[model samples]
Target chain A: MKLDSRKLKILQAIINDYIMTAEPVGSRTVAKKYNLGISSATVRNEMSDLEEMGFLEQPHTSAGRIPSDKAYRLYVDKLMQVRSLSEQEAEYIKDLYESKIMQLEQVILNTAKVLSEMTNYTSIALAPQLSMVTIKHIQLVPVDKSLALLVVVTSSGILKDTLIHIPEGIDSDYLYKVSNILNAKFRGKTFAQIDIRDLSDIRNELAENQKFFNSLVDVLTTSFREAENREIYLGGTTNIFNFPEYQDIIRARSFLNLMEEKDLLYNILVNSRNGGVKVSIGTENPYEELRGCSIVTATYSLGDRVLGTIGVIGPTRMEYSRAVSIMDHMGKALSRYLTKLYGEQP
Target chain B: MKLDSRKLKILQAIINDYIMTAEPVGSRTVAKKYNLGISSATVRNEMSDLEEMGFLEQPHTSAGRIPSDKAYRLYVDKLMQVRSLSEQEAEYIKDLYESKIMQLEQVILNTAKVLSEMTNYTSIALAPQLSMVTIKHIQLVPVDKSLALLVVVTSSGILKDTLIHIPEGIDSDYLYKVSNILNAKFRGKTFAQIDIRDLSDIRNELAENQKFFNSLVDVLTTSFREAENREIYLGGTTNIFNFPEYQDIIRARSFLNLMEEKDLLYNILVNSRNGGVKVSIGTENPYEELRGCSIVTATYSLGDRVLGTIGVIGPTRMEYSRAVSIMDHMGKALSRYLTKLYGEQP
Candidate 1:
């Protein structure tokens, strides 16, 4: 009746075997494959108890039972060992930083790719939400007679460039004067910090150039609004084909579609931004598309500031111990690189 | 043995049936469905001749025949009708620009996505090679104590931002000095135009500052070399799942991996830069992975200057008429947007 040590041990064995083969585990197979010091009959009886306890499920077609998400959750939390990455693996994550004089975008993109290659799972690197980061500089470069490029550099190392159309009166000297005023006013203010009052202040200073002022506001407002949608770089999208779970073409297609839904992943990553690795297993996942999958996410931070996430997605029967360990290690590696890249004194 | 109108009609009917059903075409079905006027016996004889000519391939496991890439090419060039887009479709492409005060990157990306959705094939938008684009402006923003963000705006509406680390003894005032000198030399000149002479000229002007100069050279060289590898935006990768050709996981994985190889795409696009619309059929493709595929590409241009490519990839039994139509429309739409955004007198 109780989840005693022996029953828990049996549960662990079934989950482990299932994770390896992605097949329903029978008591006899577990008894033969694992030295659980139990007879087949005993193992079968314990599996029945585990099923009664809602730790396993028997599909309509298969006689053998598979460990439920509940079982995997318990395994990830208590049964499994969180093994730290070895010398070479840790070195690989660390080496990602030195291997290139990378921008923040490059680091996140490469790390996402390497994470997938190493773990053989779908990976995502969520780009940091940077609207709150102080503006470092803003420049306007004339591209054509009436078009210009507005380049914005943020202290968090995010750069955004938008195309702006100049009005009739805006000339080279006028552009320079406006840029100087923009630099003076926007140099250290975040987009969140700039408001209607700031717009009015700039408008009054250049009250005569109302058309150009409207264009500038439109560009700034658009960029800030766009910053709300955090871009996600996905890697090893095809790696899902390696898993038996994706053997069904329909299931594989749906999973691929899920990878394209950025809002779903953004929410999952955002909610977990408070700290270290968080594992959402199977039915524990909020999105219907992920109900059959498990997501392992680790937050990458700079000091107390949460930048983004490094994570992987695999079938519910995942290598939990290894995924968690690698995520934890890589999370630290990304944090270290970000600190070196954007954490220096401004 | 002589080529005739009836034989071509029968081939067209077979190809159309195969494309619609993604199944091997039998002569009886083609005759019945297409109302080809020929008897099943006559259609069968024509199909055999088509197979002998390498216009069709008979699978070892099936009695039916499928169109070969050569057949698709003949169909595209000689048989297929390059119908203009429906008013709604053309309107949809045009609406993409007005709906958002979009940047070039956004326009290219959305066009790739829409091209795939409309044609039900994988699509690509090759980012413009900007090394030859004339520099319009340059600005450097100090980030951390040592880190700075370098923003470069080009006349072709491309903005590149790179991170540079400042060495000791270089103040913000010194950066302003260096930026002014950089603007003088880099403005109105393409990266190709700024040779060793320009580098030494800058060096002579900033001879007092050597360490910072070295950092600048490293960043510039990296950016220029990186530009050579054209960034390709791919869409509807999972759309391959809709086709019977990718039903085999191995073939599907190889095709997906091919999509990841930017160099392969870069070469294909570059070679097509001198043309309007190009159709490379099956064995005609250079990459082995593309041997079973058909790629239809249309070049987008600004005036006589080639900007980039818009293309689609599908099975050898592709909807050539439709894919070709959508690509040509989107390419021109993109070209029109580019010209309006950047084509004004400088």
Candidate 2:
């Protein structure tokens, strides 16, 4: 919907006031509080026009007006001013990025915690998927008489290990030899590109060591299948309770319950994956339980491939402009940090 | 407070009705629905006394009564009857336990999902801690020219991996030699029992190889430190919304927010570490934000050491007796699973 400058100002004032107080905004209240150089009657007339255009709503005949979904859309798209991060917030982000995290899980968790703490909203960050990156190296180590450890390291620096059972009497020297051969052949190849049909030929070429080669291929296939699974991280879910909008105990419980569903959350974040920042306002989310909340999400990437998304969730009347900016900046910082960690310097 | 048989029956009826309907129970309705052999007037008189004893509460003068915190306690301790799991539920749990999981994370996630689906309540399961378990074996494999991978397999069959950086030109043969020496020295000891003072002596023995030894120790420390961090899995969070009690969006969101707090959840689960089932009714939980809900928790163990907790969360009027029984059974099952995996099979 088109919004003229005067009407835009009125809508912005209503939204800003409503967000702060969580109370309806009357024409008189907006006119007096904002000093908009207009009388209450004129402001009321403008509000009526805004309502007709689906930008405002009134709860009852005597109540003041509030911003509608359309109004929030307009404000987010056109009128809302992106606020710069406070000095403390910028320092927090910088410190987080500078910290030496030992694993990708720690990095994702700390990022979510920092974002949620800064925004005073629930935050979610998904770890970079292993499938997007090629396997850099594979190592097999004999753990016991009958078991060997399969360690796989990806180009993105994620380390995954699994235990595979080898028949008794297999010497560590033979295991090492097989590991070397597999690493030489499979290094730098993505799991998707590995051909299962080639295993028989590879095993036949192992001379008298065909048994060990068959076991090695089986272990590698299992590891790749397991690696395709995704890991997700969430932080600061407790921040949701502090919002006035969730004062009711039942509503608070429902939202918390929804967060526990991994499948639902994975779908929510993955499906909303547009390249840049995307805001899903109240009722815009797919789940009915989240109809009263808004999600501000941004997809972060390592190079051109999207790694994962970072998002903040709050009441529908949330500070959309600030949330959008925070997510956008954090997304870029995370992307750059990930790229650096993966040795993709440009 | 002590309750006579009639009062006990009345309390049980009220709790059962409230759990099923999530609405206040009136004396007349109880008299009509239950074959208590009592008139509505008599039931009302008993309910009034129950309220005076803090076992029930009336929202208003003319409204029906709801179970109070005192009432839930009585029901949990004495009145409520524990029911056996339905055939479907038993089969579901069996199927879940029988499935071949890809990793420890999958096992925990699937366990949480099974509990939540069976109970129709939110479930949280914490991962077993690795530090308490002794290392079965350790293996080091060369990943690239500058990096190596360490795979540590615990006695309980859990696999943890860490990336170790090797100084520029270290060869695979040198790494293999170091791995053998380190394993001989540190294989059976838990990380907490490792002596740093003696580690320095070992480093001195390495001399020209000191850098690699130091790097290996760094990798080991990082692996154990990461494993010590609690991993929580949550399921059926959205089920909270389906309850009539959480019809108000505000209340649902507040409780949902509380569940999202990692520290809060850790504290809640760990504080009740009596190695048995624990029921914390309304206002009994340490956090005020969780005052309106009830948490039923039980700690699972590998032999004598408490590894983690598994619990269900619901409203104060929840089916306490059944929840406690389920938790108790699940705790034993998990402990047995761990014992079997660790070679302590019965």
Residue range B1-346, candidate 2, lDDT tens digits: 5578889888888889998888889989999999799999999999998999988899999899999887788778777677776787667767776765536566767778878887788998877777777777776777677777777777666777666778877887777777777687778876666655646655865678767778867766666566665777788877777777777767776767666676888778767777798899988777898877898988877777777889999988787877887888777777766665554222
How far residue B293's Cα lies from its native spot in candidate 1, in Å, is: 0.8
Q: Report residue A19 deviation for candidate 1 (angstroms).
A: 1.5
Question: Least lDDT summed over 10 consecutive residues: which range in candidate 2 chain B?
Answer: B337-346
Which candidate's lDDT is highest? 1
Question: TM-score of chain B only, all predictions?
Answer: 0.93, 0.92
Docking class of 1: medium
> Residue A220 of model 2: what lDDT?
70
Candidate 1 chain A, poorest ten consecutive residues by summed lDDT: A139-148
DockQ category of candidate 2 = acceptable
DockQ for each model? 0.57, 0.40
lDDT for A285 (candidate 1) = 86
